[model samples]
Target: MLPELKDISNEEVKLPESSKVRLFIKREDRIHPFVSGNKYRKLKYNLIEAASLGFDTVLTFGGAYSNHIAAIASAGKLHHFKTIGVIRGDELRSKKDYNPTLKFAQAQGMKLHFISREVYKNKTAQTFLEELKRTFGSFYTVPEGGTNALAVKGCEEILKPEDSMFDYICCSVGTGGTLSGIINASKPHQHIFGFPALKGDFLSDIISKFAMKRNWELQTAYHFGGYAKINNELIEFMNRFKAENDIPLDPVYTGKMMFGIIDLIKKGYFPPQSNILAVHTGGLQGIEGMNLKLKKKNLPLII
Candidate 1:
């Protein structure tokens, strides 16, 4: 809320000589260490609305390593709002110390309520929400991954008039809030592409709920097995990418989206001389926990 607009910069990415299109990545990851990228955009209006409505507390849902949870905790701390994270997998309650994401949230004064995966599936249901209301008592609800009307409104600002020159707008898809915003803000001639981090058909439905344009498509082939699921190939790619680009990518979201975009380019997906702009949605906080898992599996860690 305090003039962070000056920090964002678009860096052109190097491509092979044979490549047909020009590629650039918007360094939204550097916007803020905690509340970075689309998470910051999604929360901007929602937090303001919460304060405007006189809500002192904000509650949201997420997994153990969710970037959304970390951003919310950090945002709450920055804005002086009480935060509650309804974390999935009740088993993680005892393992909180080992999970850096949850630990960071706790350190930021987030009250975490662990729930079973089954119960988390019904998070938006009326009865479950009412039960949570009775428990937490009068808190602003930021839906899982923070996708809501106000959040989408914030996302629409990701693209600007100057960005209209680009032929394509690309970003990682989580709950589809950011993608929907890009789609809504894109120029008529530009196409928006979303690279989903999870495997599912439900995302399109969610994106349609907020998107106001039809110039978008989801590239579904590069999720790397599913949400939070990564292997050696992706780890190696991420490491090599950082070594070359000097830009660190989190394995879950940004890494997969980058991988997909590059792969598509190599496969001759884009038109010749087309300009492509990729949004670097930050999820770097999840890397610590992911590296811990990678250590256990003996997979190469993301650099």
Candidate 2:
């Protein structure tokens, strides 16, 4: 059985004297060591529904260092369900031992199927799914980022009644599931700010599909290149933030979001005395793999 989730607490972020905004971070990372934050929420009902329908296996898609892939693999092992991970990049198939995320998933008994980038792009296509079913037999399928209706439902619980007091709710956007849930659950007066980990305005459209409210906006400038892409500045900011707050931020999501929030605050974006709560969606498990890439580039690693 999956471990019971604990009540996650929020950590206050001390701001500069020039900015009168009060910032706090909801530490969802503490939910579980492996399947934490949005990963835990997104998979909670998916796993339940999969079992209710008597599915013995769970199949999903992800890249080399996907938190969703790792979370599902861990969850499957704990719940006694077989797991299949259709990983992007065919070259990674032979180098599984080098990729920490894939290695851990495999060690947990998840069967890894590495496919080319082109084929991985069509993962949601009907033909692709049909082919997967023919190859692996029937199984419950979770999307690449684990964002679906059930996932959005699970994320809605991230905010509690006390959180309604905040004027702004901030979070990093991946597939937009977590933000959608937050938008649905947020009070009318609260404005939700989403920092996309990738470039482009397409995320706004994707988020609108699930979000029921119109009180949210996307801050697309802090992506720092694109998904899984990082720089020295971001690395420095992450390390400094951790050193000061004792809260580790993953480069893929939370780190970028927090960085953006601080920059915006410095620029006088928020009115004085505004209360902002940032959602710390956990992706810490992917840090080891990220550090490997940084080492290859001789760049500073996330602390």
Q: Which model scores highest in lDDT?
A: 2
Write the residue-wise lDDT of candidate 2 on 1-303 in tens digits: 456666789889977766788999999999888888999999998999999999999999999999999999999998999999999999998999999999999998999999999888999999999999999999999998999999999999999999988999999999999999999999989999999999999998899999999999999999999999999999999999999899999999999999999999999899998999999999999999999999999999888
Clashing pairs in 1: none
TM-score (C-alpha, index-matched) for candidate 2: 0.98
Clashes of each: 0, 0
lDDT of 1 by residue, 21-112 (tens): 99999999987999999999999999999999999999999999999999999999998999999999999999999899999999999999
Query: TM-score of each candidate?
Result: 0.98, 0.98
Q: Which lDDT value does model 1 have at 85?
A: 98
Give, for candidate 2, the lowest lDDT window spanning 10 residues. Answer: 1-10
All candidates' lDDT scores? 0.92, 0.94
TM-score of 1: 0.98
Candidate 2 local lDDT, residue 131: 98
